[model samples]
Target: MKHLSLSAQRFPRRATSAVAAAAVAFAFAGCANYSGISSDKQIAAPDKFEATQSVPGQGGQWPSLDWAKQFGDPQLPQLIDEALADNPSIAQAQARIAKASSYIDTSRSALYPKVNGSYSWTRELYSANALFPPPYGGTWYSENNALVSASWDLDLWGKNRARLNQAVSQEKAAEADMQQARVTLAASLARTYNQLALLYALRDVAQREIANRQDVGRITNGRVAAGLDTNVERRTAEGNVATSQTSLTELDGQIESVRYQLAALLGKGPDRGLQIAKPVIDPKVNVTLPDNIPADLISRRPDIIAARWQVEAATQNIKEAKAEFFPDINLTAAFGFDAFGWSKFLQSSSRQIQFGPAIHLPIFDAGALRAQLKGRYADFEGDVANYNQTLVSALNDVATNISAIRSLDKQMSDANRALTAATSAYQLAVIRYKAGLSPQLQVLNADDNRLANEQTVTNLRLKRTDLQIALIKSLGGGFDATSTNLAIDGSGQQQAANPTTNQTSPSQ
Candidate 1:
């Protein structure tokens, strides 16, 4: 083995001292003065929700993470858990978090010295006439070298610190993105499950209507044979039966289509959806809305939080770009041993060391650095704008869903009353027709009205379920950034119910 010697010299002692003093002074002068923009002032949110205030017993409480469980469906949480484990979007978001975390490591590397070690061996033969005239020049020699080197870029202008900050912010954003994906997937599954239940309910209605229409057709046929009714009445009755059958067929198709959609969401094939049992949902289940929801809590929404993180990352980027306009100071050191023969490699006389400071002053580059700084600032402004838009859109979604849920409550009540009255009217018409006090047309008309009202009532009930799901989603679907890990463990085991906690708001 042989060792390699290292040597470095740039400035004399006095000159080096002066340069160090000057660098210190420049570093103090170049301290970052620009503070980032605040999303709080840029975006406006209402202090309290207006639509939810009218709901009794709401008490302005934040929604629970087990909001879906309020429907008393044992299968919903299981389905959501399966989707979270299997959904490709959720996996992708998790991958992004991993990538961003790696980036944080990359950025943090700039704050510490980089050290490397190496070992090498070389064998060479020299020509007789190159350096010496005789056998000395013709001799073959082997050399071995071992070396270790280190370098560090001093973060005098906070450039490296800014980069690290940017990476950390991006990592946080990625985490929020993961949480957002989970929230979205859970909500989608809940909606799809509810839709499936609605379809089943509608299918029952269609079957009943078909049977009623067929009965009307049979009665009309009997009256026609006795010359009490014309062929026109029989044909009309037959037409109603066909219409009801057609409606049944359409509902079946819709049911299958929704099943396939749900299967895809569960990360399974369409055939798997057919194996799912019909959902048993109570139409009377009413979801309560929170009264006086605080505007600040909107910031807890994952999408909003993700957008805020982006703004923070952009601010750090601007600071990094600004730091590039100042001078850079770097230090390097190397230690090695050089020897011609393997036996002498570890000798003290062969040992060597080298150390120096390098300074980089950007004297000229046209306007590239300034332009870069301007671009960074522009990006920061754009991020701020995006953040504001996201905030407004989030608030709008909450408000709109709240209003819809309230409206549905009233519509559902009206529909229930109308259905009951129609049912009574239908029974009266049937009794009158059997007694020969009313024409068959009157009974058929009443039957059609009852069927129509029944369908309306079912539709209203489904619509209310959909609206409640939407409202829950708008309220962040009970997703809490602090409880993300507990809510989604990715294992088949049941996740812990998300508990309420005070979450740190993003810096404005």
Candidate 2:
């Protein structure tokens, strides 16, 4: 805080004004030119993205904070809760928030006065040839000094305030980033869970296929014993059963692999996945899209919010850089005592006081200051581009998920009809084979078609569930950013406070 000697010297009023005027004139003469470095990027208007504009649905309060509950899976909410609480990513985000908060304190401190106290004592022998008097020459003496010093930057150019604002903006960005992390984590886990459900459904179908194959093998053996079928026919039927069993084995391994993935997503050991129950996803539980999606998306998506805050912080950084072009004034004062002996140190005669204004301005630094200002401008432009890109991508994600869901809905309907036909064909082939109207190969072929169709229907249904989760995530996973005033106009207004503190619902 004390950059210059605090001598107890006073300047005349007219002399101080003249010095200030000269410094001001020199500061402006040496100012950096930042005119050509302005950012041209603008935040992309939400309405300009056609895909988001045509999304249907209105007046629906979808994906509340407890969005996971809509899946009707009792275990899903608990797993997401565990991941949020125990995940390393979440912990890292929390630590960043703490660090950013501390910076706010550090920046805020500059707006106030700083005071320090110190004391020193040294015993030394005075040299005979030095300026010591005859009584003190060639003698040992103790020098004691104590002082209390204070300094405060007047901040007439608002440099410190701009710095403080920058810190605050960065903190808000960190907060939004943490929320984004949560949304990502929960969405990933849910999608993985949906995969687990799909695997279970497939496994069930495999088991049923195995059963059907075994029954066909039994009938073929009976026909061979009665001279109605050859040993080659029986062999074929047995091979079909073995093939189904192999499929079942593969499905089981896939199911376990998914369990492992789910466990990892839950931030737990592999054994934790073993304890996970089969997912019960209810496809009938519809996820309604919120109305005015693109208009409100800026506040809904945490990534967009965070990017916007980054731009806000960069604007403040430019302000701080510009402020550096002006003079910095600090009032410094020191009060202390100095004496050769401790006895005299406390005496009023030994007391000293000094106070003065210290002014600093950038007169010349080659091109370093200019380069730094230019860099700040460049950072602002980069942040603006980043914000614009994030907003565009967020809208694209929403639109992509919406369109995919609609396509999947139609696909699932077709798959269901196909599955029904396959089921009927398989039933008819079995009846015809038993009545001696069709060969055993016909029944096996029909059953294979039926199995494929069943797996297809199951997969499509579960995939639709996964997309529902994606849509919810694309909608910000119920994160309410309404209170986060993401102003990018560089007007230097304080951002609105978000009471959620950058945390999404752990249950989400």
Candidate 3:
């Protein structure tokens, strides 16, 4: 082998040593010391709900996905689909999700190097008295240059990673919020639609009552003409007719009001809502509960899921804040051509390369960094509290709906029995009056009782339907929290974690 001179090898060795020393210095100076916090920290959670008996599902089973179908209304599903597609609230939620997803991209960009390219052309005049002292006394020059530059921030303490984690969590939270909006819109539409249906039924009832009263008024008028009844009875029958007409009028106003509301929910004009036909709901439809309703299903509630993500995002924010207390290491490099003249700039000899590491130490901030960390900690604590509160509220909502449904069921049964007895009594009284065995007043009283009982049954049925809708909403409208993958770690990396199970601490 040919031996190289020591002089030649010495320069290369010295250059290599210089680069190694610079790297060591940069690493030491830019070292960050941070104790990352994990989102796995435990908070208070209930193992069982207070009103467990109200749940009808079997253990480990959740509510059916097609819960709205239980109403037996064919138009309901179509209405819900339209609302989901057109409702302003749902659209807003979806926009937020898109915004959050963009944020995730922004945060992730920080983890990698950024490369930029530029080209410039300039004409300049130099003063003879200036430092440049014009190349030739005072001269104008034209120059063209093209350059490429690259820079990257080294996440020595996972600061960028933490930011990315926060972004991911926020995106997941937004998704949950969107789901929540869908569930809420569906529930509201269903409730309003049910109300409209009930109103229509009530209006029919009023019409029937008006007809009955009118018949009574005619009979009383005939009796008075025949000297069989007094003027007082005729006036009483007319008063009853007036009352029924008033009820019918009021119901008409209510129906229109509800129609307007439903139209708004459908993202349409009031006139468009009036075009919707009267909803057909089976009054006897029963929502079957699973044999065992596990309390854990509350976690599947979209609100609860969103709350949990907020908490995790807050935890990641704390990590990011803590990381800021340490030094930041950014590496920048540029390579391109530069020269006083366009011809020279294009020459290979004009090519230049420059590279170095920039370090930023948190030397003097007047406790600003500490204050930020404190605020982040406070925010995380607040989020945790919110999560707990939301969970509890969700459980309470389910329990309340269950209790209401059970009570309504009993009331419906009793109302049915009363309606049956009143109807029978009214039929008997009418027969007796026709045969001249009972007074006209007795028949009027029986008819009033029957109408009242009928109204009770109708109102109770509406209440039952409302309760079922409430129960579905409380149960998250069949949202499955487990379908989402949200992972919050100090490193800002998403790892699949089961929301139903306690999350393990993420590796730094």
Residue pairs of candidate 3 with colliding backbone atoms: 56-289, 56-290, 57-290, 57-291, 57-292, 58-290, 58-291, 58-292
Clashing pairs in 2: none
Candidate number achieving the greatest lDDT relative to the actual structure:
2
- lDDT score of model 3? 0.75
| RMSD values, in order shown | 7.6, 6.0, 6.5
Please report the candidate that would top TM-score against the real structure.
2
Candidate 2 residue lDDT tens string, 1-508? 1122222345666776776666566655654444444444455667766653547655778576789997899899989999998998988899998999999999999999999999999998998888987679889999999999999999876778878978888988988999999999999998998898888888888888888888888888888888888999899988888888898898899889989988888888999999999888887766777787777888889998898788778767766776766667788888899999788999999987877777676655676656887787678778877977898888788888888988989998899999999999999998888777899889988998898899989888888888889989989998887654443432332222111121111101
CA lDDT, candidate 1, residue 323: 69
Error of 2 at 288 (Å): 2.2
lDDT of each: 0.72, 0.79, 0.75
TM-score of 2: 0.91
Task: Candidate 1: give the clashing pairs.
Answer: 1-342, 2-144, 2-145, 3-337, 3-338, 4-337, 38-508
| Prediction 3 TM-score vs. true | 0.86
Q: Compared with the true structure, what per-residue lDDT tens digits does model 1 show for residues 235-325?
A: 8988888998899999999999998988999988999788777887665665565554545444457887787677667767766776675
Q: Which portions of model 3 miss their true places by more than 4 Å? A: 1-41, 46-51, 54-61, 133-135, 291-295, 484-508
Ranking by TM-score: 2, 3, 1
Mark the 10 consecutive residues where model 2 has the least summed lDDT. Answer: 499-508
Question: Which has the higher lDDT value, candidate number 1 or candidate number 3?
Answer: 3
For model 1, the run of ten residues with the poorest summed lDDT? 492-501
